[model samples]
Target: MSKPLRVGVAGLGVVGASLARLLQRQSEALASRTGRAIVVTAVSARDRARDRGLDLNGVAFFDDPRALAGSESIDVFVELMGGADGPAYDSVKAALNSGKPVVTANKALIAKHGLELARLAEEKGLAFAFESSVAGGVPIIKTLREGLAGNSIRRIYGILNGTCNYILSKMETDGLSFEECLKEAQRLGYAEADPTFDVGGFDTAHKLAILASLAFGTAIDAEAIHVEGIETITQDDLAAADELGFRIKLLGVAERTARGVEQRVHPTMVAKSTAIAQVMGVLNAVTIDADAVGELTLVGPGAGGDATASAVAADIVDIARGVAIQPFGRPAHMLEEVERIPMQRHEGGYYVRLMVVDRPGAMAAIATRMGERKISLESIMQKGGARLARRRTDPPPAEGAPETVRVVLITHATSEQAIREALDLALADGVVTQKPQVIRIERE
Candidate 1:
């Protein structure tokens, strides 16, 4: 057998601790498969006295991750310390500069500084891998970078954030309000206390940036992605989706367009029959459309220490076996610059929910506005009777506010510009009492 591959792990959080345990448990099997033993030689974290439940008896400990990165004691540096610009960034750069292979689960770092790091790795002729960065243990990165190499990828989209998915799933299934579901998610540890990063769709945008690079051979540009959160989603929208034979999910989508590769993360209406719509709770599903493979969807646990550690371990095993591949599938120098495509250029079916005054000619005014924009409605669903049907979460109506009703219009394929223009006109015309809820519909 070849010499054991020494791995130095930084950040002894849940994922880092889980990785140490996994390597120890699978040492024999991993050795047999790779012709070498994969060992955790050292680790770095804040408090050395803190117990991580891993047997670190003989393993070296470093308080500073930068020391661990450049140490001669390890052959590979695994960065679990996450942050786009701080110590995580410094330490990874140190490791790559030291001519060491690097593995990480930091999606933010990859999305923000991938091209520069990939260039460095290429200059050093080293393996730089991040399988755990995107869809946890689903191996979507490898599938796009290697498995689908022969295919021309057209689109890649998925429910990339588990926290958002869990909240949405709970809201739809339990008929709970968005606030109620979010509170439950935080209580259950599925979401952070702030929860803005996950719930606000930035996390999914980061992952989508990475996926867009791998699938389209373009550089990662997170700023180019159009993002919208589930903050505005309500039970009324969920009920309307269910009635329309659709399920609402927060999806990260990247597709080829005449303008350029369009990347977006938002609340989407997918038909209930689609594989992605069937995924609920914390699970994730990624569907890729290619010329050769058609549509391929991979579903699995999107988060958790064990699931994410499994992905990290796969990268370590590949390093043990001396497998080397460019970080983004192709050489860094060859990656094309992504052309920024504005969201207004997006063309798709839409689900528009409006709170309109319950009076004569209100519906006609809204319809006339849509007609002015050349937007055609596929179906119109009106919920409520003659009386006002106010949402339970809504604030008490004022002394003399107009009685309002919920109106949902399912529009045929139309440009985002048309939809927004129509809604703006309706809002200005006093037909819409509040801001309209517009969700893009995915027919597939």
Candidate 2:
């Protein structure tokens, strides 16, 4: 009865179309639940003739999303358009500038321009929610903003990229190579034709930047966060992780450290017993550590139109119920520019796999390099093997390039700088045949 909570949607791609269908199909139930009928009055897409599998009869359509954003018929604008800039940014900005509540699933947009947008939304006294941006349906933003509002959030971390998770999960379970699993993921639509964005860790970085802002009350700094992709994760790494009773996952971690706010996205080896370690395939799991909550882990579908739309729809319902909250869990101005802690100061256990020229004193030299810096090794594994397939085009390994041995070391907690220096020394000393394959360990 409250004016039907009028809605406008931009970008009628898979997610937009799904959201349109969902609103129509669940109209009655949503009305009863929220005590306000939710209706899709305006929709925007590039193609007007293309069938969206929905009857848009009696609804307004706009070729340009910015026009729909400025329409007076809709009270709320939902943006599913992807990209860090361009139409998505312009449309959302227009909607917020006009004092309309905007809900968007654009992680890149939020990560890159969240501070400016949040400031504008606060100034206009309107809602600028992005629950669907990070970890899809996990409701992580809500948890940090509402559930843990009473406590000091110490850290937030999780497996944020489902594509990388699927690839890694397949590699671990099926004993398949990264290439094989990646191709299969592409066939299954879990990965894009150009899987660079997902596998390269930029996608995770975008999501992490948003979360870091919400959790730590810092300005979103996607560029400052250290990003490491999963492309370097080999089958041997997976096998080694399994042998050590651990699972490898690509995690985006943000924490309030002594130095400042530290955000990073990289391949992490979590112990088998951890809750996040069990999340496999396309599922995402996020853990928030706070003073009051201790550790709360949220697990669910990380992507897909339906799952993400569920989150978007929830924000709509909250708006209908007149719920108010900050876009980043605090006033945009109050979210100060916290100093960013560089990854060099990051302290953590590490899993290192080095190809050594199986000769005497090689192992001792590695040990000495670590010992010089007082870096303690938890365990050492030696697997006898032949020369790794050193590229088909390259000449044979110098006839007798010293039969290589695989030495895997699990180090106790140490600074990233110390480990890097030790590894560099080992490589320079010619004790290592190639660069070491290092995966940071996350016991929690």
Q: Model 2, poorest ten-residue lDDT window?
A: 385-394
What is the Cα-based TM-score of model 1?
0.98
For candidate 2, lDDT tens digit of each residue in 214-240? Answer: 888888888888999999998888888
Where does candidate 1 clash, by residue pair?
A: none
- Give the number of the best model, judged by TM-score: 1
187-234: candidate 1 lDDT, tens digit per residue: 999999899999999999999999999999998899999999999998
| Pairs in clash, predicted candidate 2 | none
lDDT of 2 at 98: 81
- Model 1 off-target regions past 4 Å? 386-388, 391-396
TM-score of 2: 0.97
